[model samples]
Target chain A: MIEIPYNVKPRQETGLYNAKLGIWLFLASEVMLFGGLFSAYVLLRVGSPVWPPGGEAQLNIPLATINTFNLILSSWTIVKSWIALKENDFKGFKTYMGITLLCSLIFLVIKYFEYSAKLHHGIFPSTDNFYGIYFTLTGLHGLHVIGGLIVNFYLWGPGKKMWKSEPERFTNRVEVSGLYWHFVDLVWIFLFPTLYLL
Target chain B: MSSQNLEHHKSIYLKVLLALFVLTVLTVAVSFFDFGSITLAILIGLTIAFIKGFLVAGNFMHLLDEVKPIYWLLALTVVFFFVLFFMPMLWEMNLVTVE
Candidate 1:
């Protein structure tokens, strides 16, 4: 049997499993990636004589707000799913994970309408600097949401088999996936205010 | 993995969820008010955002329970992130005037 190191126990020196450490490092890089774009946003807004440039190009605040709550609810559900797994409540885990996935799809669907609305109005990314950055930032974030949804879907579906065989490892896997899901939620937490409110 | 830890997380998760919801509403409410200065409005919005972000990261992501090396890594990332932000300031200063 090939041992998967630190799946259940922490390494003595760092007191973390391999997957936890790796996820944090990955999140740190994700921070830099979003950080760079955010810095660009700030600079562009500051340099522009008229920030947002056009009233017509303003984002749909109400829709974005709804999506914000959607992501937040998903965040809560993902954590709850992990908690269910920790308690060995497979049914509860599946229920919460299903809700989390539902929220993800709802968010993307709302985003789809929002984007289509912009396109219908002929608001392309090349419309202006504001739209340019708006599309770029939110587009990248939407991609992350899709990625997280795929992971959660797999775990909730096919990956449930791990529960019967290696429950502890299964729990760790959910925790790791939860970490990523929360990161995606956190990104939207910032992105919401930046693009919609401000 | 203990019962105590699980219970603790459950309580914290509920509290954090409530806080996040409250903060989201607060951000939206504040946006309606004219702070008299765009900069001031932006500042308040960003401050609220950072608070919400911290709550999610520290609680939901379990950053509060993470190890030292991870903190060190994040600290380093923060340093570089700020450096990247400030690099533009140097350009605006006209340190090297280019025709």
Candidate 2:
């Protein structure tokens, strides 16, 4: 069996563990991916005579506000989960990670409602330029949330077994996973205002 | 990474969580009042978003205490991100209007 280098220790050359550097590098790319679309949104909105087609008259604000809180809470819970692991409290780790998972689920369920309402109202991505970008930006974000949830869920469940064999490595995994969740939350922080308000 | 520091980290994390909650509410409330021009309103809204972004990145993501290479890499990322954001303004002269 081959053991992975820098799984638990910092690399001397870069001063970061393999997964840590890998995730941040990945996140930098993710930032640009979203940044490009956000640029498109700004260009479209700017050229249009009426941004948001009359200053936020459309779109569901209240539901979006709720989603904002949901993501924020999840961000906190994920950090708490990492902290719990750091403190060697398995039960606390499970509890916090579970809450983080639940919050993400709630966010998606509310998003499903918001999307269903729009479709019911005949507001498809093809409906107009505003709806087009709206669906594009948000749909891509929703997929990120789903992706983070998968990695987080894996860490929260079957991945916990590694705690006994290699506790520090497991905690480091949680930390890296927490960072990804926070990035997703950070995206929504900007997305909420850009889409639902202003 | 030290057991002795967990308590300190916990305190800071709780403070950050409260700050984030308050900022989220402020972002929602600010949208209700007209800040005069659309440009001004957007500036205010985006400013608040940026502040919230900083709090999450610094505290929740632990970027404040990240290693040197990671910081430089992120700094580079920020530069490119702004470049991407501003590139669209050049295209602003040509708007895509859908009827």
Candidate 3:
């Protein structure tokens, strides 16, 4: 059997483990993905005569504000969970991880209500350019949140077994996942202002 | 990482979390008032959002302590991102007039 290095420390030359390097590469590409959409947003808004065309299509800012805080709180809790794992406190890790998962659900529930309200009023992606961009951007972000939730759910559930077999690797896994979660939250940090506020 | 270093980072994370929450409130509060121009409002809102992002990425994501290659990767991404963002401005200049 060929031995695969799952928990290799930082290399002497690049100073990064394999997974760390891999995640960074993945995030770099993710940056370009969101960056392209943001560029399109700028172009579309700039080309339009009236920003957010159609005066009746208003976003629910208060609900979005609550969702923003929910994501931010989740980001904090995810990190706290990672720290708990680092400190060898499995119970604390589970508690924080559970809170993080709850926040994700709260955010998605609020988003569902917001989407339904807009759709109930006959507002949708095809309604206008603003709605088009609004639905595209927020919907994509919501998908990312869902992705994070799935990974987090696994880590909080069956994935806990890895901690016993390879403790350091488990901690590293938590750290990497936490990094991705923070990135998702960071995207929303910008998205909220771009869509809801401005 | 040593326990001491972890403890220090833990404190920093807490501080960053507090800063992010405060910035969120500030962004919402500032949005309530008219800033005279939509462009100005955007500038202010994006500025706050940028600061919040910096705190989260730097502290929470541990980008501040990341290795050199990661920084290089992000720097390259930023360059391309800015190019993509500014491409529209170039089109608006009408440098190549369409007959």
Candidate 4:
């Protein structure tokens, strides 16, 4: 087999495995992707007569607050999952990853309720600027969460086979996924304040 | 990493998580009080958000120990990200001041 360079170890000069470098580069672009929307948000809010396009009361602050903590906990658990791999405890890794997956589901469930509540009252992206930006930001973030959940679920399920054969690479893969998961959490940290609290 | 090192790292993660929880609560609690100025309130909230971001990126994502190249990569991203954020405001000012 033709070997993929720097799969398990850092490249001599760059000091990161190929996957790590690639993921970070991807995340940098992701930053700009969201940054563009956030910039638009600033423009819209500044130009609008009223802030929050939807009234401030229209948002479910308590549910969003719960969702924020839910994401934070998932970030913690995913890191623990990676750590468990380091300890050579696959069971520990599975347990933590399961919890992390559960956290993702709980987050989306709360979001579903939030969205449904909004839609039930005829609020939507088309409703006005507030609902528009609210849907745009949270909708994109929700997609990222689902993406992470799929990858993590695979890692918890079928992807564990890699561990038996190539444990180091498996660990690196987990670390990379954990990094992406953390970035998702990081975005929400800012988003929660930007959209809900502030 | 040694078992000792892994154990030590685990402790750090726990501490960061605790800090995140407290700061999140702080984010909500501060919203309840009147801060007198909207910008000041925003500054306070975003400062807390940035701290939370630092904890996640620095500790959870291991950027504190990350390589120089990645830092440079992200630094460029930050520059452009801010440019993207501020470009509209700059444009708005230009339009307002042009007349």
Candidate 5:
């Protein structure tokens, strides 16, 4: 393996910048974290009774599918925001960011509707094997969405100068946050069919 | 910068975005087929999830820009996860009853 030096004089071109590399590494760890949950989900599902839980416990596939599209659209908007920031279009970045946040809010609204419906129907984490894993996994992912939204609030805050003067750093923030946001959305990509549709 | 520059790069990013969208639709469509088993559906879904993850990580997150050293680190993390998780999986698989 050829060793690439990290240190350089301020004026020199560094072969690879630190922020981009660092975010990738951070995302790798995030992958592993989600990987654990996914693997556990598979094991539980395979070992349990027929999926969607037969008789009165079946999932609402239509509701879940709608939410799935909601999240996937959010991921696209996040990428659009990142691209806008890269081009030094702060207004465009803000517009995309706003759309992303709105998509996220829409996701949560759909989720709350689904969750509340479940609760009203007497389904919950303590209900049974299937519901237990369902609530735990999706609930955990929801918490992350809330966390991502908080970060998005700051990244898109009013009068913030980061996106204009320091485009690289701004892009980094968007990219890293996008990485996390996409992972959250990606988890639902699987969760959609598994918990509800399948 | 230039609108021309934007036009030049637009198709590439749009193409990838389109791929992501198509793959998502494919995932939803595949879930409707029972495949005669839930495990098969999960396997298919997770496989797509990994592919989507790859695109998001490599392109959206810019992991592909990293030097080889970072790849090594990622390799190590993956190997560790497999070794750590699969052993328990193996044990669970051997048990006569999953419950």
Candidate 6:
């Protein structure tokens, strides 16, 4: 059975409260996951005659810039939600989380528009080396964003009872999710320049 | 730090986020002004991106408050990243046939 204690900070136990450590380890693996793809991309860029290929830059930098802003805003909303939870403001937590989730959806919508525009222009994975890596990397990142939405959904459940009573653990959960969300954004920080600007 | 101290910390986190946003825009603006070298532009942008990653990891991810062992874990993880990210590049560069 899980131990529940009141008026006390949980000690650094071996297994139960090890979620933070476990998540970090998982993110480390994720770094490797993206790292391999990025390495392949760099190798391909070195070999390709033209960087973007097919006589088209194909990346709408301005739209992507706006999406970048939306992602950053989402990160801020996540932090705000965690802060609210720490302050024991359940309503604030729910409100901020709702905004965060909305931003995530907005990001996906913008991504869909961007991808559809590319598709309409006939840019696709098999088009060339650039498009191949482009879709692979961004597509994987998009899946992560969707996964984050599912996590946020559970957190935002109306009947969720753990959040109010176990505020510390709840806040930790938010922080962990935020860590992952920030990582996705961090990857894009580098990707935007390499894929879009360069 | 008092009970209210965490609020101050949170504000600092907000400021870091704002700084990241500004730096990102700055990177985009700078991209338009061709620095005469594509490599230079990429270098500047990547440097800023690295800084942004640090802020995100150390502040938002709560790695700053983590103990020493966690830092070691992170460092070891990065060693693996360097290995995986660069080894292929090196191999590919060496294999490129000269005309």
RMSD to truth, every model: 1.8, 3.3, 1.8, 2.0, 5.4, 3.6
For model 1, residues A1-198, the per-residue Cα lDDT tens digits are 998878778889988888888888898899889988998888888888887887645578999999998899999999999999888899999999999999999999999999999999899999988999999999999999999999999999999999999898888989999998898998898888888888
Deviation from native of the Cα of residue A58 in model 2, angstroms: 2.8
Q: What are the TM-scores, per candidate, against the unseen true structure? A: 0.95, 0.94, 0.95, 0.95, 0.81, 0.90
**Tens-digit lDDT track for model 6 on A1-198?**
986542234244422246666677888899889989998988887777877767667788988898888888888888888888777888998998899899889989989999999899888899888889999999999999999988987888852477768667777777778878888878877788778886
Clashing pairs in 2: none
The parts of candidate 3 lying over 4 Å away from their true place are B95-99
- Model 3: residue B21 alpha-carbon error in angstroms: 1.1
Worst 10 residues of 1 chain A by lDDT: A50-59
Per-residue lDDT tens digits for candidate 3, residues B33-79, read 89899899999999999999999898888887777898999999899
Candidate 5, DockQ score (0 to 1): 0.36
- Measured against the true two-chain complex, the DockQ scores of the candidates, in the order shown, are 0.77, 0.76, 0.81, 0.84, 0.36, 0.56
Shift of residue B85 alpha carbon in model 6, Å: 1.1
Candidate 4 overall Cα lDDT vs. reference? 0.91
- The predicted structure with the larger lDDT, 2 or 6, is 2
lDDT of each: 0.89, 0.87, 0.88, 0.91, 0.72, 0.80
Question: For the second chain of model 1, what is the TM-score against the true structure's chain B?
Answer: 0.87
Clash-forming residue pairs, model 5: none
Give one digit per residue, the lDDT tens place, for model 1 in B1-99.
468767877998988998999999999999999999988998999999999999998888877766789889999999998988777766776664668
Better of 1 and 2 by TM-score: 1
Residue-by-residue lDDT tens digits, candidate 3, A79-170: 99999988899999999999999999999999999999999989889998889988999999999999999999999999989999988888
Question: Model 3 Cα RMSD, Å?
Answer: 1.8
Name model 1 segments beyond 4 Å from true: B95-99
Q: Model 6: runs farther than 4 Å from truth? A: A1-16, B1-5, B93-99
Instruction: State candidate 3's TM-score.
Output: 0.95
Candidates by DockQ, descending order:
4, 3, 1, 2, 6, 5
All candidates in order of lDDT, best leading:
4, 1, 3, 2, 6, 5
